[model samples]
Each structure stands twice: as C-alpha cells, then as structure tokens.
Target chain A: MTDTADLEALRREVRSFLAAEAPTGWRDASRTQDDFVRTQRDWFGKLVRAGYAIPHWPAEYPGGGRSLAEQKVIYEELAGADCPRLLLSFVSTYHAFATLHECGNAEQKARYLPKILEGETWCQGFSEPGAGSDLAAIKTRAELKGDVYVINGQKVWSTMAQFADKCLLLARTSSDGVKQAGITYLLMDMKAPGVTVRPIHQIQGDEEFAEIFLDNVEIPVSERVGEEGKGWAVAQATLASERGLTLMELSYRMRGALGRVAKLIREHGHEEDRGVLRDFGTLVTQVDAVCAIADQFLDNRINGIERMGDASIVKNAYSRALRAYSALGLRLGGMDEQYVAPITFGDLNTGNWMADFMNSYAWTIAGGSEEVQRNIIAERMLDMPREPKGWVL
Target chain B: MGAVIELNELTDAAQKAFPADKLSPSRDESWQLAAEMGWLMVRLPEEDGGLGFTREASTALHLEMGRVLAAMPLIPAQLGLQAVIASEDFAERADWLERLAGGEYAPLPMLSAKLTQGSDGSISGTISGVFEADMAVAVVAQLPGGYALVPLDAPGVSLVERPIWDPSRRLFDVVLESYTPTLMLTDASGAKALHDRLSGEAQLALAADCIGAAGAALDMTIEYMKVRRQFDRPIALFQALKHRAADMKTRIVVAEALLWKRVRDESASVTELAAAKVLAAEAFRFVTEEMVQLHGGIGLTDEHPCHLFLKRALLNLQLCGNADLWNERVGREALA
Candidate 1:
C-alpha cells in the first residue's frame, strides 16, 4: 500500500540505479550457456549490492523488505532498461529464501539466507520425469538412515541444476497415504556423493534446465524444511514465492520487444500490407493486455484483494501472449528465421524469432502447464465440479 | 479513494436499478431511469450545472448497464453530453447542457458521416450509427464545418431506422439534405481535437461495456454448464468443457485489466485507448461465442438470452471502428 508519491520516488531511484549500473549488451554477451550464466551472475551481483535485487526479502536483510509495489518498480525499471534478468540466482533468492524463511529452522535460515545474497545459487528438484504438472506424483525416494536422509531419485526440469550449489529436493518418505502426503522437502547439496547433474538440451539450443540423479545422496535430517510427510504445504510457499513480478516483467519486456516486429514489418516492405499490420496490431494489443493483467494482478496482491485462480489467469494470459508474439515474429521473419540465427540465451524475446517461438513453450509448459492453470481457474475460481477421482484407464 | 468509493456506490446503484435477471428491459423506461439517476450527466463538470464526476464514474455506470444487457443508449448519450460540455466556446453550451441534463436526448454518432459540403454552405449526407435516434431530439454530428447539433425536426433532416442484429438497442442513419448547421460545437480547425477526445472517451466507455457484458455472458455460461448434465454427470465436471470456460474467463479478465488500466491512464494515446477497446471487444466476442457453444441447443433459440449477448458483443466489435480498423491503426502507431 505504498502511496503514489513514495512509489514514484522509488521508481525514480530504481531508474537512476538502472541507468548507472544496468548491464548493456548482455543479451549479445550471452551467446553460450556459460556466458549467459556469467552475465546473469554479474548483473545479479550488481543489483544485490545496489539494494534492488531482493526487495521482497525482509527488512533485516539488505536489499530486502520492499513492498510488492516497490518490487514491481524495480522489475519494471530492469525490464525497461533491457537489463539481464537475475535468472541464475532466481531460485536461490526466491524459492530457497521463501522455503527457508517461511518453514525452515533458525539454523537453516541463518545458514542459507545470507549465502544466497553472497551469490550461492540454488535449483528446484521437485519435478520428475513422471511428475511434471502432477508434481506430487514424484517417485523420488528418501529414507531416514540415522541422522541422514538417504535420497535416491531422478529429478528433471530443475532449472539450472547443473550449476546450482543446493537443490530444494522433494522426495517420497512414506507411500502409505495420498501422493502429496508422503512427500518430504529437503535442502540437498548438489555436490553430494553420487549426485549427477545433466543439463537438458532445450529445443532452442540452450540448457536452461537440467536433470539431477541422486544415487544414495545423503542429506542431513536437519536440512528438512518441515515435518516429514508435510512437505506439500511447504512446497506451496516455494511455488508462490515469486508471483506477479516475473510475469509483469516478462510481459513488459515482450511489449518493449514489439519493435522487433516493427523492424520486420519495415524490412519486408509490409508497411502497406493491411493483413500484416492487422496481425501486428492484434499482437500488440494482446501483449498490452497481458501487461495490464500482470500489473492488475500485482495491484490486487498489494491491496490484498487477490482471489483464487488470479495467478492462473495471469499465467495463462502471459503465456498465450508470449506465443502470439513469437509466432507473429516467426511468421514475419520467414525463411530468414529458419536459417538458424545464433540465439541469445536466457531471454524470451531475443529478436531471434525461431528460437523465441521455441522458447515460448517453456513458459506454457513450465511453472504449471497452461492446461493445469485452466483446471485451477475452472475448478477453483468458477466453482466447476471436479471429476470423480480414482479413475482407471 | 473517494473516486473508488463513489464508483462502487454507482455500480451498486446501477445493479439495483437494472437487475441482471431482466435482459433488454424496456428501452424507454431504462432511458428515463438513467436520466433520472443523473447518469446522462455523469461526466458533466459541476460548474456546467451537472454532476462533476470523472470518466471512471460514467465507465462504472456503463459497465453496470452492460451486465444486464440494458437496452438504453447510455454510451452515445454520455458521449454527446461530453461533446457539448467540451465546447466551451459554443454560445449556447449552458443551455444545451441544461436541456441534455433534463433528458432531451442528443447522442453522438458511433459511425462516420458521409457528407458533401454544398456550395451554399449547407451540408448534405447521411450520418450513420446514431443509436436510438428515434428518441433523440438531436444527433451530435461532425459535419465538414465542424461538430454540430443536427436537430431532428429541422428541414431536410430525416431519420431512417437501420435494423441491426443487436435488438437490445436501435440504430439509425441521420440523413441531411442541404441542412444548415445552427448549433456549431466546434469549427473545422478544432474538430480534430474534439474528435480525438470523444474517440478516446468512446473507446473507454465501449471497453467498459464489453467487459461488463462479457462477465455476464461468462457467468451465464458457467451456470448453464453446472446445471446441465451429460454422460451421467454434470458437464461442468468434464475437463474439456471446463477448460473452454476457463479460457473464456481468462480472456475477459485480461481484456478487463487492459480496459481499467487505460481508463485510469490520462496520457494514453488514442491508439492505446483503441487497443484497449479492441482487446475488450474481442474478448467479449470470444466469451459470447463460447457462451452460445457451451449452452448447446437452447442457445440457438431466439427466446434464450444467449443470442442477445452474442449479438450485442458482435455489434460492439463493429462500433467505434471494428477490430480490423483499430488493429491496423494500432499497428501503424506502434511501427511509428
């Protein structure tokens, strides 16, 4: 509930900070996965020192405790300045921080929270090959062996796990109850014995996510986030940690990237083509609407008026718009896009239309697939009756 | 905060006046009720002898009207009143405001006028898209000279009802055969500014209407899905149908967010405003289309309210420049 004047002041402060310290040409600098990670790390470090990186953190921590409004301002400035998004440290500062801050023991919190600011990156180990949108169906197994939790599982779709120092692992400790009830959340070290990190080569030729295999990886019992078999609730916090801001930032970036489509229009001599203009116009409006919805979602959260399935709507809208944006670019880019231009890693709207179109699938498929989001909207928000459970094929 | 509270109060009052159950309530009664409620003057400044509420107030009122699929022509009437209020140079501005506030209907045309300025300084053409002109004392038209009040009873002026698919309201073509402009609101030099202002307002108002009606349409579809059953269970339980409904809701919410954002932003360009309207109207069309499909066979009947919503959504898309026109303009602007 920041007042307009204070919000404007914060915006100005962020704008000035971005002007001074924001990385330029980082997209071009991020040609390889390693280069992308480097650019991401450098920008995250700069933002951390300038007190704009982790505004959602508590006041006791530097660059923390900013309101949602303030966080929005920072993200908006970062996106507007075309700065590199803090992709490498995202899970550390958000998911890890949230899980530790909200549900961790004091020792765990003190151990991890400070390290996060010091550039210790983390990745999620919740999704499995068989789990995905049905995350609770994960078959990762963990058993208590004295003071240590012996873990054995294969976790896929863990973003940046290949480079992560720690993994927020969700494993099945008890299979006697519902799928979600048996799960346990543990902070496992990525460097533990028999822990294998294999980066998943994405369709766009980037390894933004990886698969982690644990063959007798031992995590101390103290690393558990909550009571055994109660990890589902704790996982909710980690999932909900970063909301509104990311989508808002992405949507704004897409809106700004409309210039790419304009350039295509000009390059192809489609300026007088009514059909192309109409399609571009439709895409522009869709992107604008996505931005609006993202902004409104944040405003609702700030005002505490957010309702069930609000986040789902924002996600679906943003993903659909992202698809439309890239598709339009791909269409206009035509034979040129098919010739394989080098893609800028870790960015959705990199002006490389083919790669962008392929990367857009990440948004729709990851972070709760579009279909899953629709179910949430219908079953929860619209009060539609759910299907009978325990149906066998 | 005050504006928000007032908007809420206005919405509540409107819903109470035109309950959702009654679709296409008698147009005459609704118009009278709206005028008596001071809705026609919602945007008139206090100094102009009318309610000095902001555009949000009228937008709120329009949304409420849209929810019930009200038959009244409030959108154009409000635009007309705004046009008169903006003409501070017009000698009879005060008189026109008083007359309009007192329920003398003067509506701004939603479509362009095809006119040829006569050699004798008279204009002859047909101004189309004047909603409910049969009830209007005059139509506020943009002649070649400028924006002027074309009195319905004046010589060479005639109204021809142009039957539209949307039965909730009437549309007419205001034909002028060598008609002289007596009530000039703005000269040719000032017309573009006034046109831009009115167009922006029209976009917001229409956007609000689309959002409101789209919400209602979605609610109706959901209600039908829940009650209507198939395959030994309620269809609402089916993922296929439920997902469609969810997409419908998403479109409505997203377009609505854009509408309110543009409505609150004073510096939004005309193209930006049109972009908002285009999104909202498209959403409305999408929702209504889904509404009919989701409702099944009953939706095809003339007696059902689904057709009403569908027709209105379709018409709203065409109003204030169709999606193609606005989208091209939006594309051009973004390119520039």
Candidate 2:
C-alpha cells in the first residue's frame, strides 16, 4: 500500500517516456535478424539511459533495484507501448545478471555486470543436443587441464548465440555421481578459440537461436561460477532469473495483438459470421485470461505468497493462449496466410499469421516445454502421483 | 488487500457452514443458514441498513457456495436485492429492499422472458429460469410496462416447476396470464439501464460460480485419481491422465483470474463481464466433462456428484447469454 504512490509515479514516468521515445515501425524495420538485433540494442540502450532497463539489478548499478511491482509496471508499459522486446540482451540482463549477482564472486560481478550494461550480450550455453527439457542430462564435458577448463561438446538452442559476446556455459566436470552433480557453470568468452556459433534455421525461417560447438574451448577457472560439479544449483538461478515477468509481458503483448485478429476478421469480411466472431471472441477472452493469470502470478510473487507450481501454471496458460491466439489468426487468415511472407524478427503476432503460428510452437516447446510444465503442475501443484522414475524406455 | 482477509474469513465460514463432505445439504436448511449469515445483504449499501461490501465480497461468497454445490438460490436473491436497491424511482423501494434483505424471496429470473403486453397494459406469457421460485414471495420480471416487481400473490401470477438436470438447484417458469403490473421498480426509460446493470452483475456472479464449481470438480477428480487404481497402480500415475488433469487446473486458474479481475473493474462493459462468464462457463464445462470421463462409469450414476457439477456447468452456460450470444457480442464490441 505504501508503494502505491511511488508505483503510480513510476508508471506515469514510463508512459511519458515511452510516448515520446518508443520506436515506431520497428517490426517493419526488423525483417532481418541483423536489423532486429540493431532495433533491440537501440531500445535496450534507450531504456538503460532512461533508468528503466535492468530494474532488477542492484542499487549500485544504474537502472537497478526496482521492486517487483515497479518492475512489473515497467514491463507492462513496455508491452503496452508495443516496443520491441529485448530478445538479444535478455540472457545478459537477466540470466547472466542473476547468475553472477547471486553466485559469482565480487571480481566477476565487478567485471561482467558493468559490461552487460555496456552492450556486451550473453547467451546460455547450457542446453546441449542431448539435454533440452531434460537439462541435467547435458553431455558437454569440461576438463580442468590447469587454470582453465577445456570445454568440449555441443550446445544447441542457444538463443542469439551468434550475437552474444559471452556464454553461460554448463558442462559436465565429473561422471561418477548423478547426472546433475557432474555439471559445472562457467562464463566463456564467445570469441575464445575453438568456439563455433552456427545459426539454426527454424521452421519459421528465423535464425533467432543458434547451435554452439565447443571443441576444447577454454574458460579460465576464475570464470567458473560456484564450486565445480555444483553448476546445476547455479543453473537453477539462471533458469529462474526472469521469473513470471516475461510471460506476463508476452501475455500483455498478445492481448494487445488481438487487434490483429480483429483486423483479419474484417479483411475477410467475416464480421457478420457468427461462427468466426465467436471463435475470435473466445480467443480474445482466452488472451485476456492469460494476462490476468500472468498478472496474478507476479502479484503473488511480489506478495511472497507464490506456490511451487504457480510459475508452471502461468507458463502453461501463457503458452496455450499463445497457441490459441496464433491459431485463430491462422484460421481467420485462411488462404492468404498459407502463402510465405517475410517474417519479422523478435516479434510474435506480427500479422503474418503462418509465421506467427509456427513461432507459437517455440513457446510450447522451449523453456521447459509444455509437457514438462504440465508434469510440474500435475505432480507438484495438483499433488498427483508421479510416475515411477526407474522405468526404462 | 483488505478484501483478501475478508475473503479468507468468508471462505472459512463457508467451509464451516457447508462442509465439502455434505454435498447439496438440505436446500431449505442451507437457505435458512445463508440468510442467517447475512449473505443476502452482503452487497447492500451500508446506508441502507446492510453490510456495505464490494463486489469482490459477493464474488467470494458465490465462489465458496459454488464449491459445495450449494442448493440455495443466493445468486438470484442477491441480484434481486441489487435491482431493488438501484431502483430509485420505485415507490416502495426501501420497504421492498428491507424485506428482500430480511430473506423474503424475490429473485430476478436468470434467463430471458417472452411476454406480450396487450393494449390495456396487461402482460401474458412466461419468465423462465427462475430458481427456487417455490420459496419466492415475488419474481423480478422485466415487462415492457417497465422493470416491475411482480408479486406472486397478485392475480394471474403462477409458478410452474420446470425440473432441470442440475439437482443442486431447482428451476421454474413464472407464468403470467393477464398479470397486471404493480410496484414498478423502474420506469420504461430506466428499464434498459437497470436491465444492463443487473445483467452484468448476473454474469459476474455466474462466472464466479462456474469458476468455483470447476475448481471443486477438478479437486474431486484429482482426489479420485489418486485413490483409484488400474493396472496395479493409481490411474493418476499415467502421464496421459495427469496431463489432462493439469490442463483442467490451468483452465480453472486462468478463468478465475479473469473473474476476479473483472469483478474489480468498474469500467468493464456488459460485454466484457459476459466475456468473463463465457470463459468461466467454458472452463467449467471442460472440467466437469473431464470429471465424468475420468471417473469412468460411476460418474454416470445419479448417486455420483460428478454429474451434478457437469449438469450445473451446462445449465450455467445457458443462464448466461450462452457462449454463442456473449462471444459474438464480445467480438462485435472488440471490433468497435
């Protein structure tokens, strides 16, 4: 209650700032991945200079130390303004910041944290080809030869690795214990020798994510976060870094993008078609409900009353609504959406219904996939019985 | 924030009053208890000699009542009271409000009516979806003569019981044959405005009820899954069933969030509130259907409560403008 006035003031400030400075026609400008990255950096830099970026950072750092409610207001404003999401620097500002700030030593923090603000982007190198939803099953091996750990293995699905200057590398340092226990977390310079970054051509024809090959790439032991073989615990911090904020933002964006569906309905002259209207209406409410749940999820977190499966519920709800949103667009677009159109980078619901539909799958399949979130919801939240773990496939 | 504490207190009181184990406890006795607890006056203005509470308070009560499959017609009763309270032009508004608040039954029909007003201003035809009309002193039927409080004891006013699939509550058709209008709650000019106001409130209440019932249905299904075994293990151990249950939870939680958000939003249009209802009703329908299927053949039996929830959900969908009506309106509104 005490922060109500402060939050209003912050909201007002953000709104006025966004009204004047929020980029227009960024989607059109961001047709190519390079243009998208440039747009993202410009927006991120503007936010940083305006003291709106990295609100979750420490008080000593610029644009840091915002409360969860304040951070929520910022995200809400950004989404409401239709500003480009900070996809290129998401890992650097959140995942990397959370990891170093929580688990890194003072020197690491002083060295890397400042650089993130200086446009040094980082990508997660944790998900290997063998890992993904089963993240602990990573096969990337790291050997400590002397002062540096020689990392050798492949990491797939690393978002924006091609543009990243550093990587949150998770590699197996031991094999004698549980799969999760053998892992170690390190910060590796992307320009380091024996490191290769190749963009992955997605089904939607966007190279937002890339595959990283580490052929004995060396990361100084000083760059290692936490103790060796304890990276899984640190990785949890990284994975949990963004919390429910991204989904909340995305939900708002989706809600705002409902206009696209409305536009399609009119374009196709289905305004009088009760069936199409009903479907559009259903999707509208679905998106609205997702926004509500996302807001509730963050409110619960801010109130310190969030349950174990709350985030999973928010994630699953958001992904399903995203699927429904894009599906409705694709359905309403009909024949026109079937044709290939140039897709916008780093934006969902870009009015290109087919590409947007394919992009929706990324949400369902990535970030601990829909199936995994469902398991968490069922087993943890609902208290349903877990399947016997020892059964082999 | 204060409302949350009130909600918790209300929830605790509701659990104590109507335990989940006693499903659909004697409707007459439960109605009496609800009246005694001042639920009828929960939404009444404090200046009107009733507890001044926000819509959230009433929403909380409806939700809790819904969880137990309450047989009491609290929703209609509250809506009826709200209608009287909002009718400033009515002559006996205060007296009618007092009686309604003190548990005299005068419920606004949940569904629409088809009445023809003759040249002499007399009304005929029927108002359907009147819940628990057997105990009502009157029914709030919207006549072209204006929104009037038609007393059941008046001439040509009769109640015909219309049995429904949902046994948790009873329904009736308030039949009118040359029924003369009296106790005008609102004039012809005010009728449309009051109807819109109460319709929005009705949608919120039903949405809350649907969400509550869906939650209860999902809880029941999950509990049964944990205990019921097949193939030498609890059926909940299977991934397929667990995923379905999880999806049910997700739908309920999301819909509930929308319900609460809409309840607090005073600027929300009737279409928006109805949209909330559509979402909640659909979620409830989904959960109850899953409940019946997940419980297997036992769910089909009359003795099982799964069918009760499913029936209530189906009926709730119609009580609202139905998903089809509300959804189209919502789409139309969004387009504008």
Candidate 3:
C-alpha cells in the first residue's frame, strides 16, 4: 500500500533531476552526430555518480532504490530529454544488469552488477551468425575443461563490442533434444583468448553492429549462471527484459515524430489543405490510440497483471506509428524532399527524416520481427493452436 | 459488453427466433411465425402490448435478426407501431400486438410503414420501399393532406414488389394517387420520435448483423484455406495466406470491439451505432471478397454462400451510411 503522493514526489524528483541533467545542445541529435560516444559515456558517468543509474535495482545492491514506477520515470526522463543511452547504456541498463536483477545468483549479483552500474562495461554475445530469431539454434559450444569451460562460437550484431570489456555469452553445453536444451548463460571476458570483434557497416553509415568470432575462448565455469545446459531458459529471461524496458524509447520517438510532422506541415504551408487536414486528423487519431494502448500497457504492468503477449501489440503499434510519422514527413517533403539526394543539415532536413525512417526498419526485426510477435500473440493471447514450428531452430 | 440489456426473451431473437423455415430461404411463412412472435413489437412497451423491453434490448434483438440473415420486417413494423401507440392512435390497433404475440392476427398481418402526414391536411409521400408492402393489411399513409390508415387492398393504393437484392426481404414500391384517410394529426412529433428511435434501432441491427456475418465469413475463409491445396500443401500453411487470415481476424476483433462500444460506451448513440455498421460492413466485404478469391472460381458462384455475404455487404454498405461518411461524422460529433 504505497501512497500515491509519495510516488508523485519521487516522479517529480526524477523529472527535476532530468531537467537539470539534460545535456546542453542536444536537440534531435542525429545518429552520426560527432562526440556521441564521449558525450554518452560522460552522461552515463554523471548519472552513475549521482546514484541515479541502475534505478531498477535495490539500494542494497549498490544501486538506487526505486520501484518499477520510479524506474519508468527515469527511462521517460532520459528519453524525453533525448539523452543518448541506446548503445552506451544498453548492456548496463538493459542486458547484463537486467539479467542480474532478474536471474542473478547472490554472488553473481555482487560481482557483475557493480561493474554494470558505474558503466564500467559489458556486451551481449547472444546472437550468432547461425542464430538470430532462432536463438536456441546457436552452436557456440562451451565445453567444461577443469574448473573452466572453453568457449568457441561466432556472435554477430554485438552492438558495442569495440569498447565492451566483457561479453555476456550464451554457449551450447550439450547437443541433446533441440538446440535450446544444450545451452548455458555465462558472463565472459571479452579480452579472453580467441575472441575477435569486427564492425559491420550499417545502411545508416554507422558501425552499430559487429561480427564477433570466438576461437576456444576460455572462461571459468563459475561464470555460468546456472546448470551448464540451461542457456535457452536464461536467454529467454534476458530477452524478455529487452521488450519490457525499451518501450519508453519507442514512445519518445513517436512523440518526437508527431511533433516534427506538425512542424513540417506548418512549414510546408499545407496546414489548411483538405487532404493534409484529413491526414493530420487521421494521424492524430492514431497517435491518441497508440498513446492509450501504451498507457494501458504501463498500467497493466504496474498493477502486476500484464500479458507478455501484449508487448507485441506495443511493438507493432509503435513501429507502425513511427513508420506512419516518417511516411508523413517524406510526403510533406514531396519531390523536393523525398525523391532527391541527401545533403548536410539545413541543406535538406530529410536527411534526419530519412535517417529515422531507415532506423525504424530495425525496430521490428531487432527484437524479434513483428511476424514472430504475431506468433507469440496468436499462440499465447488468442490461444490459437500452435502452427507446426516452421523454423529449423 | 453490450449494455447489460436483459431482454424479456432471447437476445438474438430478432430474426433467428423466427423458425428458419418461416424467415429464411424466401420467408414465405413469415405470416405464421415472425409476426406471431411479436418480433415487430419487441421494442414496444408491454403497456403498448409489446414485451416491455428497453431500447438496448430491442436494438439487440434486431441486430441478432440481421446476424442470422432473418427476413422479418421488424424495424419498419415496430417503428410504425411505436408511432401509433405514442400518438394514442392505437384504439383499434391496441389488440393487434396482443394477437401478434399470441400467434393470432398473423399469416399476413401488416400494419403500414410508408405514410408521411401531408400538408393542406393531405398525406402525399409515395412511401416507396415499404417492407412487406404487399402483405400489409393496410398502409399507414401520412401526408400533408391527412393521415390515413388505408388498406393495401384499397383500389387507390398500389404495392409493387421492388426487386430487392435480398430475396428474403420483400421491399415494396407503393404508388398512391389519392388514398382515403383513417385519422390525421396536426402534430406528427410522435411519428418523428418513433422515426428517431428507429434510426438507432436500424444502426444496431446493421452493426450486429455485420458482426455475425464477419465471424461467419472469417470461419469460411479459414476452413477453405485449411483444405485448399496449392504447391502440394494446404494454402493455410502458406505464410502469405496465414497473414491474410490473421488480418481478417484483426478487423473482426475491432468490429466486435466497436459493436460493444456502440452499445456500451456512454457516448453510444446514433453516431456510434453508425460507426459500428461501417466497420462491420467493410470487414464483411473484405473478408467475403478474400473468401471468394481464395476459393478461386467457385466462390463467385450462386451456389456459394459468399455471394449472399457479398449481397449483404453491398446492401449493408449503403445502409445506415457509408463508412467514410460515418467516420468523418464521428469526429464531427465529437466536435459538436
């Protein structure tokens, strides 16, 4: 029976902190904006010093004591302020740290949790070239040798492997049943022998993803979270956190997109045109609908009665909203803005618009494609008879 | 989520409650079963010889009728009766509904649907498209000249069956040169109120029927895909086909949501009901069309239920109002 007034005060305190900490000169900063890494690291450090980072973890764990409500406020503040935490804080704020909060053993928490909170470093080694959506299909084998297991596998799309000091690796421990039963979740040192990271050029001209090859990488068996062949279950737990935490970022993008469109239309001088008005009206309706659903999703989570399947609805709705907003931006730009070559800022703003448009394709594909989401929704929520599993994994 | 409308009888009793033999496959026996059940008087009060139902209850009944593709003229009949009762003009017709519910005064007991009170103390509207016009015992003709309860058998009155797409429904075109009067009222608010009340009723009927049809249409498509083989496998196994079926399910789900919203939302009214009709009709047409396309050539035939659904789609599309118009008006209603 927490008091509403108390929650409001905590929320206000977070928001007030956000207003103070919002980096100067950060307004719609593009993906390739210079000084991003340095700026992000600096921002992450300041928040850590302020004891505001790792807000979801309890205070006793060398983390800020905050309820889910307070944790959401922090996410909202960071997103609303347009603070860059995606690649920078994902491992600390989302992956490894999230795993520690959820499934970490007592000793594991005391060790890996502290490094993540101060943003010292961590990286995910979940996806392999052989395993993407079919995560359990990963063939990264970790064999027990003495007190340690030697790991050998390739991981792709390791977002920040260039700077990450450690890799939260998932490796196969047995080849029984399906690929899932033979895996284990482990915290591995990135600097270990036979681990190599190579950046991949993205469509957006940034190396946001990488290909990591592991050749007999050796790590203590103690790094494993649970039994050797239980990786798939732990991986599922970690992946669940990805969906639960990132929704606020989607909302922020949607709001900013909505705002930009309003500004774009007004600038384009079609504010009063019938077609444009209708489009605006429709967009407004959709935005309201999305916001309502998002609010409801949050309420359900807070009430401790939420459906995991509904996360798909939010992902689908949010991506589509972002796409809708981006499409509208392109339309407003017309031939001059759309069907033209990109230029630097002030030359043509579609570069930013185009960047966002390109970025949204990954929203669906990144955290399990919308098609996979449909399967989850159908099987779990609607209780549809399972389609014979189509994938080899 | 339809308003907790505890009806006196069944909810889907609109047309389905009528024995299938009497109301469907051309409704030749409506005179015996439909009229006998007091389907027309479902919305009327017991004081007025109806079963004493709420507006939501009555609307729900008609909706259920549409869902089953029932061919009873409940909307027009009960609407006309409501007017008669409200105007205190039911002195002679008072026993009509009692007999209706008792399975008497049926076979072809029709009161009127087409008479508009006229000016110059004369009623003159042609009242075309009168449902069950030929079967009417009399035409409730209202005009500027006067209000007349003229028997359909009267020489001056004409009831020509207007070839309707819904073979089950008998829409009539009435031509009256100058009909004799039954009773005229200087004020017609009673009739107007009934008209107003019936608009909501028609909306609910169209929406609910569309909901039922949409469900049926999706079922048909899913079943068709399950066995229809292409590329050496059932088409339903194809991801492309599966996604289309999934989209249809989404629309039906939305339509169902809107149907409940129309009946339950505090804002539920004429406009909300109309929106439901539009959503359901569009969904019905979309699903039915996909059903046919999936069936290849067989779906376009008269033998298939697809055409019937298509007919209802086209009919419902134009009925109440078109979807775009309704969607636009919903926003306007909010603004107002």
The candidate that wins on lDDT is 1
Selected candidate, larger DockQ, 1 vs 2? 1
DockQ ranking, best first = 1, 2, 3
Which candidate order results from sorting by lDDT in descending order?
1, 2, 3
Candidate 2 docking classification:
high
Count of clashes in candidate 2: 0
How large is the interface RMSD of candidate 1?
0.6
lDDT score at residue A173, model 1, on the 0-100 scale: 97
lDDT of 3 by residue, A1-393 (tens): 346788777668777887787676533343342455666677778787766677766677544677776666667767676565556677767678767777778898888777776666777888887788777788888889999888887998887687788888888889988767888888888888898999876664456667889898889977888777877777766776654546655565465446667677677886556566556545544554455456556656877878657677776766666677667777877776554343221111133566556666777687778787766655565444466775576
Candidate 3, residue A33: the lDDT equals 29
Could you give the interface RMSD of each candidate, to one decimal? 0.6, 0.8, 4.3
Q: Give stretches of model 3 more than 4 Å off.
A: A1-26, A29-98, A113-123, A159-167, A189-200, A205-208, A242-314, A317-321, A339-352, A374-393, B1-212, B227-234, B254-281, B326-336
Candidate 2 local lDDT, residue B192:
91
Off by more than 4 A, model 1: none
Q: Write the per-residue lDDT of candidate 1 for residues B1-336, one digit (tens) a residue.
A: 898999899988999999988878999999899988888777888887778998789889888888988888899999999899989899999899999999988999998889999889998989999999999999999999899998999999999999999988899999999999999999999999999999999999899999999999999999998889888888898899999999999999998888888888999998899899888899999999989998999999998999999999999999889999999998888898
lDDT per residue as tens, model 1, A1-393: 688899999999998887788787888899998889888888888888999889999999998888888888888988999888888999999999999999999999999999998899999999999998889899999999999999998999999999999999899999997888999999999888989999999888989989999999999999999999999999999998987899999999999999999999999999999999999999988998899899999989999999999999999999989999999999998898889789898899999998999999999999999999999999999999987888999
- Give the share of true interchain contacts found in each model: 0.86, 0.73, 0.00
